[model samples]
Target: MNTAAWSRIARRHPSAFLLAVQLLSLMVYPLFDGLPGGRLVFGAFGATALVLAVWVVNRSPAVNWVAWSLAIPALLCAVSAAVFRNQALLVTASLLEALLYFYAAGALILYMMNDNRVTADELFAAGATFTLLAWGFAYLFVVCQVWYPGSFSGAVEPERARTWLELLFLSFTNLAAVGLGDVLPLRSEARVLVMLEQFAGVGYVAVVVSRLIGLTILRQGRDS
Candidate 1:
């Protein structure tokens, strides 16, 4: 309720804050999509998510400067692209963002694996890392779409470049190994990326997530 209470929670559960913001952004995005003010709103959310991600990374074993290095330029490019509608800036921003998300995901993974005992924050990091990977792949899709037009085709507009939401949906589906929906990747490069994401999804669940589950179970057994 108060600043002190919120600060304590954040201090104890940094990953939870990042995870909550990512999920909340998903819900908030649809409202602003395709609107005149959408770019500005998306930029604000992007900046917030980046900052939260950096905070989460700082809590991990990774070098904090790397996260900040990527984040500052990514933020600047995002803002410039949104303001000027520069295609080059957009592509650069997308690429930088993808790298930053992937880096953050890696840091979180390392944090989770660093200890045998799973804490509440580690559990939260698991979910947050998954979202970070999803986001990273989605940004890659954005770059792919720009480089190879018509790479993705959806039921709504088969000829046009897919919206951010559509690309993100595709990314999630592919990463989760779920059956594809109306959106499909038509280009070879896109399909290759999708396949890579599929492998990553399977490996993450089989390795990192399963390890977390095992550790939790082991702890529970010892307590019992």
Candidate 2:
């Protein structure tokens, strides 16, 4: 496709593209991290995430400068950690990632709230932010595990893929308040964090839906 075509698609379906990239990374990480070119797969995931972050930064007028400033260093840290294979650097990269996603989520939420009429793009952005919340927590859980061993039960293997996928799964389940017995938080800190995530999940849904519905009804009233 030409540059114009790509630009049009991006403009029209920015959230869709962002959601696809994030979901793809989450799904592919565990499945392919065990195979060859694992580093490459990780690099690709980080690249796509960075691209989405840049897109959000450019699209958001008010926070674009802040987003750009933070995103550059986060992207650099991600690349550096992957290249150098430094454990400490990876932790830094992961923390940066969580922060960046939280920022992106805030920007998207701001856009959603400000618009008088909600569009598919806005709804998709909302969903993307929700998933990003889970993603951020996944990274946080990993950090917790790193800092305090046995923070979680049923985490047997030490492989990076296992660690990530397990935590990602746990994060989502906790966020959604749908816990399976496969993994459980053993540490007090982990339990407290999980409670916080659960609260966030419920509160986010309640607020976003109510805000969107209110906006829609107000717009309709004005139109009628």
Candidate 3:
């Protein structure tokens, strides 16, 4: 689509397109999980979606640097996986993805918190940030598995799709503080990371709720 089309959609709904892409990715990812080059394709799609989402939400030229930084590593990951055939490439990709989405989540959360009145855009941004947090932790778990063998009990082979999927499943469960016993963090560092993610999840809900309620009350008072 052209810039004009994107601009029109963004003006109509700031984060709706981004949220739809994310939901679509979540829904379709399982179909491609086992196929060759599937991860890279989805990674590229997700990176592009995230960059566009940030652009739609922020509309600042300064954020272009961040978008480019995120996109470059994703492109490198595709090339590295397809051409070089390196297992290390997955590790690099995971790290890059984790950092990029973490930054995106932070930016979105900051934007939501700074708004004087909560709008639909802010609500969508908040949801996006929550999803980004889950994704970031999933990638972080992948990195830990790469660095320290047997960091997770159920994920023996770090490079396989099954292991990656398991880590992602565990990441979301941990974020929700579900504590399902199927996957356990064996390493001290891994456990620490899980704990931190759990804390972050709780803290995020608290902060976001407080901010929204505070803003709503302030808006009502001003109108009164």
Candidate 4:
């Protein structure tokens, strides 16, 4: 059904609904995948689906950006697939699905935090910690492809293994002077994701950081 139905079902059949979404989202990589243009159309729907889920389940701006941040890679894959008509996009598509699920779980964390007020330091710490962890994981994946070469499928043909990692890391990094040039996305699809993530990363920092910082400063001023 729709988001309302899914959220309600989540209350009673949470596991079932979660499993269904998660399972359906996963796709095979480096093979003959679906058409790119069609995938983009699907990506738009997926984005809407995710946003709806986030809105219906629990609307936290922080969590929304986090989920959108994750969605970037998948949307990139869909775009890449549609634009270039390549199968390599599926690899990143799978990555997006994983990110989506984790961010979706983040919603629950935000909900839990609602009960106990978390400080700015706490929020910053949590964000930074996750950012670092995500980067490390992405770094390892990219480095593996770089050093091993073909260790990951679609690393050579599309040659976007390192690039994917870079985009993924940028998605989590959230900074003004991001991108050190060590990881540059080469392919069309990877580049699309890089641009989108950079835009998103900047926007998230501007909005979330300012608000969070304002709240933190206010909290500290009040408490002090």
lDDT of each: 0.93, 0.77, 0.74, 0.47
Query: Per-prediction count of colliding residue pairs?
Result: 0, 0, 0, 3
List of clashing residue pairs for candidate 2: none
RMSD of each: 0.9, 3.0, 3.6, 11.6
Q: Write the per-residue lDDT of candidate 4 for residues 1-224, one digit (tens) a residue.
A: 99998667556443334333422433322122344444455455455545544442343435456666666666677567656766566556655654564465455335424534545333533353234334324433443354445443332444434445343444454334454544544445445444654664565457555555666677788899
Whole-model lDDT for model 3 versus the true structure? 0.74
Assess every candidate by TM-score.
Answer: 0.98, 0.85, 0.81, 0.38
Candidate 3, poorest ten consecutive residues by summed lDDT:
53-62
Candidate 4 lDDT (Cα, 0 to 1): 0.47
What tens digits encode model 2's per-residue C-alpha lDDT throughout 1-224? 99999989889868778888888887678777667577668777876776686586566544677766766777787788777877787788778787777788777777777767888787778778877788888888877877777788774553333367778888888877775647778789988888889998888878886788787788789889
Of 1 and 4, which scores higher on TM-score? Answer: 1
Residues 89-116 of candidate 1: C-alpha lDDT, one tens digit per residue:
9999999999999999999999999978
Question: Top model by lDDT, which number?
Answer: 1
The predicted structure with the larger lDDT, 3 or 4, is 3
**Candidate 3 lDDT tens digits, 75-167:** 588467656767788788778778777777777777777747778777777777777788889889988977887778863544343366687
Distance from true location, Cα of 221 in model 4, Å: 1.8
What is the Cα root-mean-square deviation between model 1 and the actual structure?
Answer: 0.9
- TM-score, cand. 2: 0.85
